[model samples]
Target: MPNLKHLLLLSCLGLSPACIDVPPLEDPPKEDPADPDADFTFTATPAQEQVLPGGTLDCDVRLAWADTTGGAVTWSLVSPPAGIELQPFTLPKGETRATLSIRLGAGTEPGAYTLTLQGKSGTVTKQATVSVTVGKAGDLVVNWVVPTPGKAYTRGPLLLQFTVEGGAAEQVEILKDTTVLVKPTGSPYSFTWDTTSEAEGTYQLSIRATRGGAVFTSAPRTVIVDRTAPTVASFLPAKDAVTVGVRDSIQVTFSEPMNPLSVTEAAVGLKTGAGDAIAKSVALSADGQTLTVTPLSDLTAPSTVQVDLTAAAGALTDLAGNGVASAPAWSFSVPTWLPMGGAVSAVGGATSTESVVLKLDHDDRPILAWAESDGSSKNIYVSRWNGESWFMLGAPLSGFSAIGTNAATPTLAIDTAGEPVVAWGETTGNGDERTVFVRRWTGTTWESLPSPTPPSSLDTLFNPSLTITSDNTINLFTSLYDTAGYSIICYQHSNQAASWQQPWELHDDPYLFNPGAPVSTTSGGNIFVAATVFDDHTSKRNIAVYKGKEPYLGGTTLGNSSTTPSIGADSNGRPWVAWSEFDSAPQSDGQIFWARWEGSSWTAPVAVNTRATGNSTPSLALAKGGPHVLTWSGIIDSERSILVSQWSANSWQTMNAPLNALSAAGTPATAPSVALNSTAQPFVAWTEADASAASIYVVRINR
Candidate 1:
């Protein structure tokens, strides 16, 4: 081509004559050829490089050891991956380095890729290698350190952390047992778990990582959840507490959250000192840690109560499913224990005390009737309990201007309508002639029957025992001194306003004489009576028992042989018979013994009192349907105290304290009668000896 400036200038001169002359075009200088003796070498910034699909990697390849000869070099590339794009790059005529830009295809396959650069000088060609590792579709790697096997985690986070290598990750996930705990995290490969709602147990943890267009999974690992067993942190009405109100609820606090259904009435027991379980209900607090036990009925006052926790019944458990380590039991005292009445006698005391009879009124409070012998005459009196003290029901009902020598032993019982009924024997005509009179409470006041329970006859009347059957029938059992010799009599007063029926003979052996007082109770419409009858011909006296459809004792004897018998029944109408038997040892008078009817037959009569010297007048009673209690006069070492015992462990056990410990030579503990309220707590009353000036004393059995 010709120089273009001269032509353009000549054309401009002709067109305008004022055109400036431009310098004549000149050819550039040519450099010398590259030295053929120089050596050639090549290198890359990174020996090996990596790139993810749809990603780029910038790298430098240096051609060092160049000849600098200015010899023109020819450049070309060799062997490049199909998914890799080598951007156009050229090295200067004599340069040391060149840049390589590698781009990966969006859908590239995973494999090793090689990129080569060739520098040619004359007949020689020098090459450098650049490796570009393109990641596959699912190229993201995932790994996790698992929790220790059988490991336990407290109340905190249970985390699942994973490490990703190779390619970049777009999402991650963690899965627990049957649940996906960690959802897809856009960029993070770790997940944290909350341990609160989870129960104590073993579970599996798994991980999944997603990168590009593929997903990867990790082997499952184990995770644990645990919490300690709940503990009894504190309790209300603390151990051995006193003066607690009857209505107060026992509250128990726990150290940790608990399962509410585990706390039950059977799991937590409450019992009176008499070893009778109290009526109660269970309540759980909103926090699931506190439990309150409320008494369904008022607690018997001035009594010790036991609280028990059952370990086997699964009483309480923690969220971890752990139960109490042991069965726990404790006790507290109710100082306000209710007393039926105190000192049922004159202000200064009386000359003598008659047998005291106890009965529970409709409301379950006690009503007592007893006789006081002021040296000359025996007076019969009635009284009602106001929970604390006692007051006379009415003026002396008997033992005053009567038709008998003196109104003697009086007995008490409640009628069908929950009315108090009292019966006593009074002397009439001659000193030997006696009659038994009857009176019933009209709810408002005491009402006297038109006729005596047992009409007077030529025979002397002994003390009588009375019981009201479920059908509201009043039954009378007594020992009658008839012309046919000593005989046991049975009288029934059909309805409330009915007259007495002709007495049915229970035992009428001509050889029987000097009969002791008789006691009786009814069970399941059947009657049980116990009495001591002495053989006139022989000095031997034997106790007799009768079980009949009616109120009379004519059944098999309780013991092999016995004397001075008494009887009682549980709320279930199960009868318990107690009596005195002469001991086998020499100089031993009698030992108190007892037996119970377990529906089919009587239990082997078991001896109650240990002191064989002088045990007499066995009396029996039971907590409505709970433990049984029996009392008797025990004269040991010449002390003459009322040694009381309770029925437990299938035997009689002594009270924590003796019922009567009066050791005074003139003082005595005699004629004890045992009774129980609706709650099954027992109350025992007896005459404190000092016959010259005696009083009726009462004590409550607080287990």
Candidate 2:
């Protein structure tokens, strides 16, 4: 085209066409892009938040900067609800995150709200939007931690626990009905409600939680406060019952329901009269109101058993958590009577006559006194069983030898020192005069007591009965007969007195014969006498009982056509009498009847012998804390046999076999006497007469 310069100029001048054909000088090499501004981005971890009135919510705000360095960022909330506040805070320079706390104040309305969070640094600003919800009363809930609803509480401490959800509790209170009972402050809210001072009734319980100035209450829970203690409603084997079975179980009923778990073997127990513990098992009824105690083994016969309920802490508790304040106890007894060893003959001879008197010493040894003739004369003799054989106590008490002058009607008793005391009637040579003699054994010899005054010459003393009192006094009762009539006399001799006391006529009715051998006993410092008197007007003999002295307490008639009256006393100082009564027409034999004097009157007479045979000469004795024992002679299968029976369990229980005359079927056994030992055993003494002579025999019954 043209010269270089010219061509260049022309090409340059021709720019329109040349510039289009030539590259546009490569657009002057474009420069690299520059970095962004040094600012941060504001964002929230969660886009939603929930908070209850008087509660707080926390949100995490993060800053993402484009550069390694940044200034402090101020935090703020936009368009927040009334009473809502954002905790003033700022993210320091070089920090990447900050916490935003949103708090709702008291009395704040509940609703859904949107909160805009703003963060600004120098001339830069960033914003984040978050959804917020203010919780209402329905959002706050209270749950019971223990003592579930509808449970009853007794007079004790009760635990109350509760938890608050959807809110923070600053203070918690327990409300009983509309009243505030207590204010508890702690985590896992709980309190001990002492109900010991509360009245018994139904009440409503609730939990009240307070945060800031707002309060929330839970629904009412129904509960019962029963502060009444349980009582013993009834028990088995009624107190002091004497007829309880050996295998009977004890039952105790409560006035209200009891806690089943509290009824254990350690809480109830049984014991023997000896204070020995008895093994037993305890059980509770289905309704949780009764408790039963069963012995592991059968109780011993003739033993007293006691039942005990413990009153110790944690021993027994009712459903309301009340404990027994007092221990309950009771006692009962079992009865048994069985014969011991075979009967032994005390004395046998060709001339042993009259009734034999028997007594037991402190050692339970048998002592005897009777009248026997040696063909030349009759005298009163004393003997005792050494647990082996009979040994004479001393020489015959009387020295009479004339044919008509003889010893008879010997009555025997034992003193407090376990010494023998004897009383008898001795007739003079002419038989029209008789004297009453009493003597006591002083270790080795018989010491004669003062002799009672003699009646008129024609009057004769026949039968004599004697007893020794607890105070060492001698009491003697006798029968006197004269031309005018017969009368019974009572005489007493005290160890301190100079001589026998003035005799008192017990009964003096002309139509009444001398009461035969008026039996006497001492109880509660008073003397009681019983006898058989012949009533000429009724043409029948009747039994009479008298108590005390001079101004007698009783002259009560017991039975008609009755004989052989025996008297005794009980632990309560009450008098008990037994006798033989003749049956009605067609029955020639007699029956034994017994009666006890109550505080005011006498109980109805009860028959002792079950059979209709001739039962006569009955003797009665009462054992301490035991039953009454009786012995008599009866005709069985045309043979005379001695019978023994005991009044127990409201009935008479007769021994299985006859006591005497078992080997000699035709021998006649008569005039029986009974006594009880210290161990409550019964001993019987009787007379057996064969074709040759009469003899005395003794037997015992074990418990």
Kindly report which residue pairs in candidate 2 clash with one another: none
Top candidate on lDDT is 2
Q: Tens digit of lDDT per residue, candidate 1, span 426-497?
A: 776564767778788786676776444444545666687888888987887777766665666778887744
Model 2 scores a C-alpha lDDT of 0.72
Worst 10 residues of 1 by lDDT: 16-25
- Model 1 residue 40 CA deviation in Å: 99
lDDT (C-alpha, whole model) for all candidates? 0.65, 0.72
Query: Model 2, 108-207: lDDT tens per residue?
Result: 8887777788887777878888766666854655555444433554455666656566757877889999999998876566677777687888778888
Off by over 4 Å in 2: 1-349, 399-405, 455-457, 507-514, 535-539, 550-555, 583-587
